[model samples]
Target: MSSSSEEDLLFAVALLANEEEEKRERKVWVHNIYEKRETYGEFHHLFPDLLKDRSKFFHYFRMSQEKFYELLNLVKPCVERENTTFRRAVPCEERLAVCLRFLATGNSFRTLAFSYRLGETSVRRIVYDVCDAVWTKLVPIFMPQPDKEIWERNELEFRERWNFPNCVGAMDGKHVVFDKPANSGSLFYNYKKSFSIVLLALVDANYKFVMVDVGALGKNSDGGIFSNSIFGRKLQQNKLDFPPDKILPGTNELMPHVIVADEAFPLQRNLMRPYPGDESKRNTEKRIYNYRHSRARNTCEDSFGILSKKFRIYQRKMQVSPEHMTKFVLATCVLHNFLREDHPNLLAELIEEATPALQDLRGTGGTYTGSALRIRDRFKDYFSSHAGSVEWQERMINVGRRNTNE
Candidate 1:
């Protein structure tokens, strides 16, 4: 063919290609949402007026107006965008609102896309960015940065409020359930028949999470997770901000400030666990010690209960990766502490989610050191003494025998 014939063919092809590209770009598709998601944009866009109705306000945002505004302001610098000539940028308020709704409801990006009036892809980026920002900006504020002063304060709160002496925090492990990832084995799968990532946390007396070591395999036992965790390793190496030795409530002998947990954590001088009921000793004193330890340990249990209830997403399995799920857990925990300021009852609504066996007081797989055993003895002695005994202690001891008799 001649050069002119080839040029004509190439020109025609270029014009057709441009026409196809424009047609694809200009095509408009619409869906019928059936009005279910109407509240998605309206209440979020029209705030203070909607804030007057507390139930409606909280039902959507999962946080009060004041708290939402406070968070919006805190994350505004990171999430807010500058408008360009191309199209107007998404406002900071809307960006944060999109994330809050995602965390609050655990709805899919597609489901929230309709509610927030954005593409599913946009919603995905917004959710991830806001979660990252919240964890980065707010973690330092909400998470307890323990030191000498903070540790002492925690001990005081645990003693005065929970009636367990010299306790710093209640530590526990929770499996944040998620779907098995493609191309992965049983690595993330647990005995519960679901894939999950573990969140090993130390919760203070006030139901606030003090420290968290997340992203452990769900199949790992709590003791295993703790021993392998950053917080656990630090505690073992004596590198954390644990307070110096303090005198026992009734004795002149000084003991290390410690965290109370069930048998799932290894017993360290700085960490206390309950006595194994099946072992050699089932004596009344040991029983009393177990009772007192359970009292302190319940703080962690109650913390998880409140956490799961407040963030209903935790109750269901997530579709994200283990890494992203860790972010979600940390973000929820930060919000949990922030919201607890206003709704401080701990509102233990989802206590029934985990079984007693899952929450069991199994001793950590680590060998018990002599000093750790001594700490347990010291606490046991204190609980039996007049200085540490609550008015209900004796009755609680008797009630145990009564249950056995029945």
Candidate 2:
């Protein structure tokens, strides 16, 4: 052979040798530390001890041990994986524990992997899978579509607890902040200068989320988001199965069962918002009406506050994709409703810090129907009259004015 041919052969042999060396250096499986997960993992080593202390278990997982097992049973079938000859699959219990711990603390996947003695990639997959399972299994049970009876029950609760006559639920939107996605500019950016997704919810008097519309872009206004949501569409079309109009509790005038919202929502026949402008502040009846409206609408704020306080995932900007973040928020909301049954007074314990008041987002320039305007005026008159007035409403309005003047 010629010298050039011999050199070509030699180069081929050297290239093969380098490839063999690279293959030998590469990791073909997980590290030995992960294989010893049962002996070293927090789920195995620490969770048993946690079960012995109910309070500690609750604090660790943000749910009681009993509730944890109940949730585990519901989600186990979906998250469970069969063992293979290569290795045993991570138990459904451990998968759920990892997911809950991540949500409770909002820790990074790396941090959780170390605690669970699993691969970081494994932790990420487990969290996503388990969150999907939780939402699928629990949403229907905890947040069923309301019927006429359900609407009336909610209305009664609102009247008794909030003293807002003919009210069914309180509606609002919360922004769930997350890292902006690649190749998407200003799509998820909000006025707050953060990238987020909107969680628009209608909450009942007892702080349960009755209906939710998640995964809306953060840049959208609350009114716009509501107008485009399924819940909003149903409400606008009178297909929500709300109860028939009834007489105001102490007045002869008939009124529809309504959802109370802040000024960020449009005024509709069945939706009540505070009257606008300096005139509303100066008019005694409008001031009283606004005060009572605010008192009832606060249930929605308190529900969001309790949810954020308990889950804590919402306290920090999440690092997951918007799709996964939506799953996380929905799962947390399901858990919130589930846990509310066992912890009825949970919201009473947390003191939500006062946030600086934001300018209310006005409704779009669409004209309001005369019927909507009349319904609002009827509520306004009812709230100012002795039949609909609460004893402290006048005092509350006065205090609000005093604060504004100061």
Over all chains combined, what TM-score does candidate 2 have? 0.89
* Model 1: residues with Cα > 4 Å off, grouped in runs: 1-7, 10-13, 16-49, 279-281, 344-364
lDDT per model vs. reference: 0.77, 0.85
Q: Indicate the residue-level lDDT of 240 in model 2.
A: 94
Look at candidate 1 and tell me the lDDT of residue 96: 84
Q: What value of lDDT does candidate 2 attain over all alpha carbons?
A: 0.85
Collision pairs in model 2 = none
Model 1 lowest lDDT segment of ten: 353-362
50-145 per-residue lDDT for model 2 (tens digits): 999976787788888889999999999999999985668999999999999998888989999998999999999999999999989998899888
User: Any idea how many clashes model 2 has?
Assistant: 0
What is the alpha-carbon RMSD of candidate 1 to the true structure? 3.6
